[model samples]
Target chain A: MAEFSLIETIRERCAVARDDVRLGIGDDGAVLAVPIGHELVVSTDTLVAGVHFPLQTAPFDIGWKALAVNLSDLAAMGANPAWATLALTLPSADAPWVEKFADGFAALAREHQLALVGGDTTRGPLSITITVFGFVPAGAAVTRAGAKAGDWICVTGTLGDAAAGLACVLACEDGADELIGRLNRPAPRIAAGLLLREVASAAIDISDGLLADLGHICARSGVGAEVCVDDLPMSEAFGEYADAPTRQRLQLAGGDDYELCFSVQPDRAPALLWDLAQSGCAATRIGQIVVGREIMLTDDSGAQIEMPLRGWEHFA
Target chain B: MAEFSLIETIRERCAVARDDVRLGIGDDGAVLAVPIGHELVVSTDTLVAGVHFPLQTAPFDIGWKALAVNLSDLAAMGANPAWATLALTLPSADAPWVEKFADGFAALAREHQLALVGGDTTRGPLSITITVFGFVPAGAAVTRAGAKAGDWICVTGTLGDAAAGLACVLACEDGADELIGRLNRPAPRIAAGLLLREVASAAIDISDGLLADLGHICARSGVGAEVCVDDLPMSEAFGEYADAPTRQRLQLAGGDDYELCFSVQPDRAPALLWDLAQSGCAATRIGQIVVGREIMLTDDSGAQIEMPLRGWEHFA
Candidate 1:
């Protein structure tokens, strides 16, 4: 069979297209029509070998995390993912690896209902980049510049699990597989974000550590924030791999948390909290948006706490 | 400055936005409002180290070609270029290389009036993947399945220049810079495609060589093709870089042409040719869609000629 036949084999068994998808694989390009009154949201992420993940990492995890990160970006914008395209570079045409990778990718894509539209595969060092598209109504999508003073700052689920997982990998700690799995398989807060779209004024995903990502929202909205160091959420599973101080450090400075961090107006916070509770979402009031241009962390006794301005810096 | 900051620097310097761009950089996701009566077209491509190009290849060419190839896909679909997201991976944070890559990318992006909505930069063996988006009115875009028996097959510009350029590079042949440039900076036939949107019945970009790509259109449209070997638009520059047999090989199977291979109905052929001439487009009828299931080639005297299938293949 020719290369096109090979592509046909892969595309047939890959991400299934939805009815709304006007076109799919085996064309010059895929065509999709967004529903009326809905806006298309797009984001792209690239994962490189040796830098983003160890060479020993599973191909399935790599595919899953690649899509998950882009989905997290969609969640941060309060958009529902509808489509995605993957650009994969590999060392060779390995069948077993492709099967596992497709399994991981299809599982996450099905869960999120994201149809795979088009993609390209080429010979190169192992790398995966995914470009995802989502949809939301006009003027209703959450943004980074919509936050205001006196807004309740909230975070979905927990933070630092991925960070803790990375730490376990770096330290070669025992029972690190669980943490590594968390690092490899991040859960994008799709439902929570869609639910909070109306109530939240601004939102972002925590991938560059809580402080850094929060700073982005604050800077964009021209408001400061005060995150209570004590209010931060963590999994007890983290403690199995880290000490208290290490866990604190990991939670504050480690990156790759795909949870949504959002700001809700003080007046709407009560109803939002109730709705979140009803949905069984573990939403936490981490702090409040302040008037000034500085991010401060407060202790359990309401005392100010100091920490380094450290996070994942690509250049460094 | 950090690598992320470097990316931010490029983003700020090349800040491109239009009303259709509902969201740009600095947001978790980009939102686009496709104009009414239009459908979105999407394509992605990936280039890997030592596979797509030589390691010593200039970073600028790499950047240009990455976006150019995707633009060709949109062109083949008879779509108007709109937005693109880049996923770039590198071994290290090389400042000068990054600057040049951005420079080449921004220059081409500005020329095409395409917006850099969003992308991600990460560490790994050097590779670049770009996903491009375009818009074509509903029911108007050309596709591979529109070709019909007795339709005239046409191609824009020349072929084999880029492939011969690669041969020159592999042989360390000097004075083939023009051919190499063609290889590195293949022009997507956007203008020709736009002009042919209403006239052409089926189309595809010549990436994996003319025969292979046209074979795709034939299989999809359920039509055979009779290409005149004498009519193949082989660039004179190709001969300057390779010998007779080598030139014929490049013309037959060497890839990276980025030209539009389209089919036009017999009656509409005259009007289309006139329009292309008026637009100063270099296009010619190279073949005819036949009623059989084979891609046959004929000489000037109408004798069938046998040729090798030599396009780029992932599983070959």
Candidate 2:
């Protein structure tokens, strides 16, 4: 069967030898040994062609982003990635496309020592569903429910780059290579998450823009947040392409920024930020958790800013 | 957002509170504790609309079969299902459709005590990707690589019912409700698998027909198999609809059975069959593992019976 052969192609490309994987591909299921005293963190995400990404997006980027999004979920939980399963639905058996996709997926899996343990490839419209498995210390997983009202909210890396990249793609504009790269390959903040587990009060991956994802943290923690719109970090490419208003809108409401939005005690914020920067994951404080139920966007003069949209909702 | 509210609907319906799940839905990821001294068994499967099922099939049936197929994988590995993550992609957020789907998913999940841990709902052509997590004792998983030359090859339940059910659906035939039910709702042989772990040398779930799935056990074990065509089990409904040759062809090459095809030592086969019967799963001995690389079928008089096709292959 071509399915078996295609799976063999993926197995060969993603053949990472791990001691914990007792059984890998070509079985009913993958058998994994989770270390004692560790909890398993599992996350699943699906990327649909033309919906999650543009129809003309390269297969390589689709594969990378599919797994990257799921990995970001694990990163938000302060887990070390270990294994993943891919359920790929393709329109046809385009061999070159599959090979490039596997290459992209394998490259990222190799970087984190994550094994492609098992997967299903089927005939259908183009979509990729990736489920990632990682491990964290028992009872030490950073959740979205641990923030206090007085904690400071911080985010890793610059925002709005991916959104700007999407804009470039849509407008068929050229020469925004760095912004495009950000959209194609958003890094999963695994290392920073591991460090944050020790000090952060709560954490979430910023997939649905900074404001929307921070709202998730606030809702789960039963607190509100006051974001200083002027403090949002933006890359040079994003600044060069989008105007001031567009920048604020994109950074605050853009989806697909795979950064970490987390809350930390004000007393430990400076040290934690320094540690994150030393680990190559620079973070900036953008807001404060407050004792209310509504997320407030404040300008430099402490005036409230009215945002049109919160985030991307699938059905809305 | 509506996505969160939709997830809340699913969460309320499929909520099976298990102690091992520290954090479930509404989080970036789910944190789960694997029991001490057990290995995690993971499997993933995706069901694409019109490819995995008829487009007119009920949402409830689609929901049940999606999770059931994945559960069958865990059953093949002799693992007890514990948690599952669902990634559902739909054209729109039809609240009623989602509610029915969740009910069907929750019904089977509750029977096996499986918890829906975390999931993602996205806009796309309809599809459901489920990754199931289960546990088996260390070194005790029944894999397809353990069948010895003298092992007795057996199968649980009858074969070809699902294919016949699909035929009825396609032809718009009536009074084949039982067969159609079999096609829509396959009972994963979880209990029988647990018992087989004690005696079966190797096992695989018959998703891709009896011959193809048993062939997997043969290929993995470096052995061959010989099946007696007359001994293939068939339900009364299957016999009523299919003539002898049709019955033989359908049972041998039809897919989506969700039954277990296992090989056990001849000495232990009788006792294992009895135990499985006591557990309400009947077993039928149809073949024997042999020392070669080819799968052969023989009639009652030992005459070779040729099969036109091996099994269903995606993108074939």
Candidate 3:
């Protein structure tokens, strides 16, 4: 098969209907009609073989994670995704492998009603780049720069599960595979993110460990953060893997958890928490923003805790 | 160095201010305000090392050609270039090499007044994937499906220069370095494309040789075409090549031209030529669209020309 045929195969299986998609998947370029009173949110992410995922990972999981990461970016901005373009590179053309990959991608795309609009397929080292385009009402998108000194910090769902999942892959651990599921097929908190846009003062999705990702919000918003270490959200699966030190390390410095971490004013914290609960979203308040530049941690005793702030470094 | 710092380095050097770019190269993903009454145009292209270019080519040229290819796609749609996101993968963190790459990218971006909105950097085999967004007036965009049987086929700029340039590199032909420039640095017909949108009924940018690219237009338009061999525009430098047979092969099957091939009504041909002349763009009428499905070729003597239709096939 030629490059053109491979692209057609992926496109046919991935097509989803949307009225706003003026053109999709076959042309020099795609034409999209942006609705009035909305601004487009676009972000691109690339996932490379071995570097971004385990070499033993299934092809379906790879395709799922590739689009999941870019959608995570859109979710962080409270943008409703509408369309996406993919640039796929492969070492060789494998028909069955590509069909499963397309199936994985289409499954997630259908959930969010995102249409595959344009793409390019080429022969090279295996890698996937996806650019997702979404829209948020004008002046309504949440940004990392909106956090204030007196805001309360909270996180949705649980953390440290994905990183713990990575550990299972590294050690070839079997039996309990929930963490591995979290690592390979992360559920992007799109609903929680869209809800937080109205009540939260600032927002971000955690990808590179809690500390490193939170530090970004502080650096951009010109504020400090104080996290109550004891208040860290942990799943039962993560808790069973290790003792205090290991759990703490995983929660604080482990990465690849695509959960939303956001902030709200103290006065509205009650209302936000109530609304999130009503929406069936489990959220926990774990920290507060301060006027200083420090990102400090504290134990139940109210004393400072010291630890390394490490995340996944692509070029370390 | 880490991915974040490398992104920051490229961001600092490639920044070009535009009012529409609400955020550029920082935060989670860049945000933009699209102009009202316009439709967004998007396209993506990926270039892999040792697959798209020579292994020994300069880093600067690679970056330039990477952005140039996607820009050509947008040009084919007759859209005004706006924002672009880059996904760059590199095997190692080489600071000076990256800087030069960014310099080459920024130079072309500044020329078109395009803003570098968002991107991702990663550690992997070298590849660059660029997704460019542009805008065209609603309902004014020219598509490949608009050609009629009577439309005259036209092309902008000379053919076969870039292919001959590649041959020079393969043979280490030092005396003819101009073709090498054509191979390494292709000039996309942005202005001519924008002009042709008002005059031409169907348009496509020549990337994978004349026959292949034009075949795309014909396939989409449900029509056929015939090229008068003697009418093909050739650069003076290309005339110094081997003999007629070699020249004919290079003209028909050679790829990487990066020019514009389009169809206009026969009645409007003189007007288009007049406009192109005023704009200092060299274009020629090569043939006419037909009612059948074959892409045929004939010489000045009115004899049928027979040659292989082979071009750059990625999977072949």
lDDT tens readout by residue for model 3, A18-49: 99888777788999998999888888999998
Which residue pairs clash within candidate 2? none
* Candidate with the larger lDDT of 2 and 3: 2
- Candidate 1 residue pairs that clash: none
| lDDT (tens digit, per residue) of candidate 3 on B1-316 | 6788799888988888999887677666677888999999999999998888888889888888888898998888888899899999999999988998998888888889989999999989999999999998887777898888989999988888888988888787787777888887777677887888777999988888899888989999999999998989898899886687888778777888888899999999889978877888778999999998888999988788888776777887
lDDT for model 2: 0.92
Q: Write the per-residue lDDT of candidate 2 for residues B103-193, one digit (tens) a residue.
A: 9999999999999999899998999999999999998999999999989999999999999999999999999999999999999999998
Candidate 3 predicts chain B with a TM-score of: 0.97
Q: Rank the candidates by lDDT, best first.
A: 2, 3, 1
The DockQ scores of all candidates, in the order shown, are: 0.73, 0.80, 0.83
Best by TM-score: 2
Give the distance in Å from residue A73's predicted Cα in candidate 3 to where it truly belongs: 0.5
TM-score of chain A of each: 0.95, 0.98, 0.98
lDDT of candidate 1 over B105-131, digit per residue (tens): 777788778999988888778888889
TM-score of chain B of each: 0.96, 0.99, 0.97
Model 2, residue B126: C-alpha shift (Å): 1.0
